[model samples]
Target: MNIKKGLVLGISLITLFFTTPYTPADDKREEKGEEKKVYVLDDIVVTAPAIISGNEVNRLGSQVTHVTMEQIQDLNAMDLTSALRRVPGVVISRHNQVGSFGGGEGGAIFIRGKGSSRPGAEIQTLIDGIPKFVSVWTHPIMDALNVDIVDTIDIYKGAQPVLFGNMAFGAVDVQTKRMKDTGFYTGIKSGYGSNKTHMASVEHGGKTERFDYYLLGGYRSSDGHRVNADGELQDLFLHMGYDFTAKWGMDLTLIYTDNWADDPGPIDLSYPSDGRFNNDDFFMVATISNNYERAKGYVKFYSDKGDIDWVNQEGTPGYDTLTDYKNYGIRARETITPWQKGELMMGIDLDYIRGKARFLHPVDGNSAFPEETFRIFSPYASLSHTFGSLDNIYFIPSIGVRHLNHTEFDSETAPQAGIILGIKETRLHASYGKGINYPGIYAKVQDNLWMPGDNRWSELEAENLDHFEAGVEHRFSSKLIVDLTWFYDRGEDRIVTSPPPPFPPILTNIGEYKNRGIEGSITAIPISGLSLFGGFTYLDSAPDDLPYAPEWTFSAGFNYSPVDNFQISMDTQYVDDQYVTSRARMRNTVNTDEVDSYFLVNGKISYDFRLTGCDADWQVFLAAENITDTDYEQKKGYPMPDLGFMIGFIAEFN
Candidate 1:
């Protein structure tokens, strides 16, 4: 640890704590009788700051940053990875301009230097609180996350075992959109951009006294900027709900997506090869929820199934592999306010995974495979209470624990605690949590067939993480806010390959690593319709030398509406040079290959207006990415696209 830096930060926090002005809380708040607050990282992003990736502090008082739909539009992002590039503590990598890479390191998202592990990842993705990923590979399928259906994205910075388990060392959850007002509404969007990129989407939503429904469908394709590097994506989703009573309701959601991408090898390929990956995914989530004066809870059941087919055209003898997977789970939680300023919460999560993979055309005597199942049952509870006077300063403390039971492994227990202190517009928070992750079924399948003698895969223990974080946020005015956070996390018993070479690759658990960092952001709206934001991240990792964890990251952006219907937005970022592939991780050998640091700027301009006699509002925008046309590469041999232009329009009406 850097003692000097630590001391400086400590002194700064103390100084801020003493200087912030104090104000009394409002005791006569409106009553929410028989209406429980379902805190699904809950926050309605009705504010204007969504134009830039922004932050929010939930009732829990820890870090829970977010990016709203308005923000996604400003960036003209069409996919999950692209949509998160500007968020603090997040870094994304990809090979092509339009489509996400499937087999290797393409379309990967890393937070605070974690999630670089391929075939298995530390970071997880969720849709409406339901986990979604390429179960066979134990990682996210970037293309499967359709941004057209997302309303708000919540980012949980570090290990949050109490709230989310297993793959949630770092997590991003996309909350689906729901109709807010009565009557019916429809939205249509379309765009055309460089590299022959084309995209279109349509959505309809409505809400009544007792029923609400939302439906969406979209398609996008690109003849990428490189030879044989084309991609296509399509998606359909529907959501319906019926309120049985003022305090009880049920809802169901169905999602489907089909996408494919082609890899044109490296930039300078001596011997060319064509690699294509295709995926078809479908999932559903159903929930029965209730709210009351003293208690609120919901039971959610979800199921997902997907197939991935990878055609590797290595040399002239190309081969293909297909992986089939299915996932089912239930999530239920309840929160009860037993007394004044006191509450208790409990929840359980059950996840089951089953899958099989095999080569379409036999190779190295590796032919068929048998299906296997993995189950996870975890239950958790927590309590929180407010202390101090409502007329002055106040404090909130929280503690929680979770028990993990896996069908294929021994059970484990994880715990967490947190505290929040606030006065007026300033807040301070601190937290600690433990994270655990077990190897995916992919590990066992490989040992069973490809390497016949390696039957010890099932003997590996789950990995563990110790996470800690502290932060302070101060809102000077309705338009200006500043947030600073310091975090550190340590890993132990991480599984990695032993003697990674010509001998024999054996999976083992002798890896350990730790990372510490400081992240801060400032959002300012000096005048009406104008918002400016900037942020930076500094990270330091020991002995392990984590990959894709840039030591320094900087981002800045601004959104301005000079007139009622005219807008301009621009975003810029700079990332320090860092290693690119999983080889830098313990799964293989750490090497010296690294990518160069680069700076980028992107801009968008739009106008919104309503036809003279029509009630519908229409918006048209022109977006340009990589305005500087700087040459940069997130991975070796795969250079990102230069300055590109996109023209798009949107129409909405009731």
Candidate 2:
């Protein structure tokens, strides 16, 4: 059905569900000598809390943003791309739609105009502090991680702290849910919208005196808005924990995703006869944590595995490529209160990875590729001191360093320092840090395959980055808060793909890039039931060739509830003109870059209610995205979908 019909049908269903007649169970209860109880809609309204607590935000030494589960639900976000775009200084690129596969080529996220042309390269992604990406290629598959089980997301815009290692130019940390109370609960959410898209999810969680468990499974499929673009995804996540004693505990997490997509190619080209991509990814992590009066620590072991296959049918003889990768790592960290108002932390990390790539010829069935293995060890420490308050003012300073040892490269050291000053309702903070990015296995193996006797591989060195940031936050009153931050990053010896005369393309460290930007945001509660939020970013890059780096971006939104049980929310985002390389031009002839810009508006309405005889709280919501039906492209030649609508209901029971 078309979007218009789907929206009308969805609204009709919701109204019918709310107003349908039913036998009053309270009457039967009264007949049985029990008191009749009535529930008012006012009591059912739920107001979401702030994304991050004030205390938590103040304790961090770096620039950070948090997205809570409540906010995710309010936005009707089904994936990371949808949810992360709301954050300042973040931009996301998707080939066509969610669940589509483009290898390490589909989606890219840029932060402060710095991101790898390759996916997941510029930013590090972690789940519960464990890295989540293909170790061989050093990139993440957006669809491989499920959003249904997430409880919160923490985003670090620039160089991360010492606790995280390896690629930390920017970081995204995903935390899953854990049972809070000792009771069983189950929920199901389903929705349908334009482009023949549909989604369904089931979740259950329970806790006992000594143990707790949570599980979620979901599936999404869509016949995309473009021709030959169809995708499907199935994901499952499980989390369990056991408390052996008051001070010791163990927990385990497992995730699996199977995704498939058919590439439609560029809009300017004819749809291929057969173009498919498939991936089966798995991740598991187990941890043991201890809590003592003076110290706390955890030891964790994690494993990630991925199997992918891609086929191109446009060739004379359709060929397919297959990749298999496995990565396992162990991490340990301890935090100790060394003295009054002082703390120290230390950690160690070890990782091992193996990967193999195969190219299959349709006629010969000959598949062979090199298998590579690598190991890494890193140790880090940090110290912090909090001085006694003077005249109601507080001061804190911290420093940290990490030493990395790699099997194939020279050792490297990274250092960071920061300070925070607070007085009354205002805070001032500044920090400086250094980060490094090592070459991935793909580059090493590809060098061996294409250039057997070249010394270019050995000459490659780890890229380095220096970050500096300062910010101030003020709470004008109980209902208003404002924040402003400035950041500058300089990168040296950056890796770039170079195709020199009479030679194949090779990875080399031959470029330098820099970015300086400022971001500001405000949150205000004008009245009891109304909230307002808005943010803007101004970015400047040294080079003019940076693709997809917009100079100006702004977002504004508000939530209001005129009635007790009904809420209305609206948000708008503006992206200034940015450069993008044309996908179609590259394939057909010489590559060309183009500039594009767009504005998007979205709105939602929700009603909360509880049936008189039911023990569940229900919320029905309708959300419209891109209401203006603006025609734009995040990636040149790949036009994003026009106006879309989704109507869904959420139910919770205990």
Among these predicted structures, which one has the highest TM-score?
1
Global lDDT of model 2: 0.72
Clashes of each: 1, 0
TM-score of each: 0.91, 0.88
Report the C-alpha displacement of residue 334, candidate 1, in angstroms. 0.8
| Cα lDDT, model 1, residue 583 | 42
lDDT of 2 at 474: 81
Q: Extract clashing residue pairs from model 2.
A: none
Candidate that would win on lDDT:
1
Residue-wise C-alpha lDDT for candidate 1, range 155-258, written one tens digit per residue: 88888887788877888888887764555666678899999999877776666788877777778889988886788878878888888998999999998888
Check candidate 1 and list the clashing pairs: 34-293
Displacement of the residue 332 alpha carbon in candidate 1, Å: 0.9
